[model samples]
Target: MTVDHTAPGDLAPHPVDLRAGELAALLARAHNIPADVHRLPSGEPVVSVYYGLVVRIDDTCRFWWVVPASVGRRRPLWTSATVPAVAASRIAGHYRELRARPPGHLIRGGYLTADVLMEHHTASAPI
Candidate 1:
């Protein structure tokens, strides 16, 4: 795991606003990963593209998380935006439209870049 020396800012938590059925459908269609939290032989937690990406809901927040493979991990990777309410009710329609194209997750970036900016900064085009 890599370390970010930067401190995380306080993000205002959001509540889960979708109905149970809608939430279930999104999990079925978009990202239906099993979420049995498990540990490595060394006693570190396991996290991976297939085994990770756990979505959880509480009274205060509906959040996605990447369970780290080690205890030293301060935080798991996450989406920048909370699960939007409309996504649940409207995502089926979006999925129908996207049926023709390759699934979004199947598409990988052509290459990588080292555009490491501080939090809240935008990446500018190089001259």
Candidate 2:
């Protein structure tokens, strides 16, 4: 999916207070992964800890990391050889906490909308 790029100040209807790099660092430090933080062409920070994984933390501080659903289904959810176990567990806990609340709890500044989650779910479902 293409990321909508507009001036950070003009993009979101509301102020985006979170820094992607900060969130990524927090997650990485919490999980103990060595975070390789880089800025996208649009200046958004993209953190890569493992070879095949990339996490994009939007302006709102919500995170999205790409991983194979089959790998996701395995034990100690979110574990990857590329990510430290502590980091994986932290990420898993983040999702667990988010899942406990209504979807609205995670929504902020129009980033990571429910539609995105739905689309990811639909796309990842078995054929």
Candidate 3:
């Protein structure tokens, strides 16, 4: 999937404002990933992933989590090893799916960086 890399302001705006609950439901259904939603210290909604990693939907800074290379090892409690390529493809696909949906104000504001998306795709591809 190719992403248009124009500035965030260039995209057409979303029709509706989405609430946290709505965002949570959309994400769960779209990505098949369960996320625990919470409020940030600044009051923005955040979704927590594995290993205490938190992603704030409202804040652009914390949206993506880079799965560490150590994840390939059985660290502490993790059993299966996570291959970087597999994880990257999964994440890139998820973002692509989200981007295909109807525009949303908050979504436009919290758009993922194209470089990050492409990195995942490239890293995940068979060498």
Candidate 4:
């Protein structure tokens, strides 16, 4: 498990606008994507989806696509406030697009960045 050193005042409380289990159910029912909810060591709930993607709720109730990394902080694909069903569809589409990519293809530029980010992440992802 990774250790967080941020003081309590600086730390964001566990998200209340979104719950992991509820999002998982939404993903399954709306997008046919089977998602799993797991709690962080800090007790924050997160949703694990296809292609090792992670969905989390920030303090403001915005959904975040977080890339898990062994080193450095987790990266966010995007942060925005949206309905659960829309978020589920977007996550599912991203998963499908990732799965559709051919293996060993050239990785460059932003794609390369994303690939490297993926490598750094997923080291401890449940999916």
Most TM-score-accurate candidate: 4
User: Which candidate, 1 or 3, would have the higher TM-score against the true structure?
Assistant: 3
User: Tens digit of lDDT per residue, candidate 4, span 85-122?
Assistant: 77777777776755565534324212333233344544
Cα error, candidate 4, residue 51 (Å) = 3.1
Per-prediction TM-score, please? 0.26, 0.39, 0.32, 0.55
CA lDDT of each prediction against the hidden true structure: 0.32, 0.45, 0.39, 0.58
Q: On a 0 to 1 TM-score scale, where does candidate 1 land against the true structure?
A: 0.26
Cα deviation at 30, candidate 4, in Å, is 1.5
Q: Where in model 2 is the C-alpha error above 4 Å?
A: 1-18, 71-127
Better of 1 and 3 by lDDT: 3
What order do candidates take by TM-score, descending?
4, 2, 3, 1
In angstroms, the error of model 1 at 3 is 58
| Model 4 misplacement above 4 A | 1-18, 66-76, 102-127
Candidate 1 lDDT by residue in tens digits, 50-113? 2122233333434333222234654433332245344333433333433434444223311111
Residue range 78-109, candidate 3, lDDT tens digits = 11113323433454444454444555632343
Clashing pairs in 4: 68-121
- Tell how far residue 27 is off in model 2, in angstroms: 4.1
- The clash count for each model shown is 0, 2, 1, 1
Determine which window of 10 residues in candidate 4 has minimal summed lDDT. 105-114
RMSD of each: 16.0, 14.7, 16.2, 11.5
Q: Show model 1 residue runs off by greater than 4 Å.
A: 1-21, 30-50, 67-76, 84-127
lDDT of 2 by residue, 69-92 (tens): 333553212222223343355554
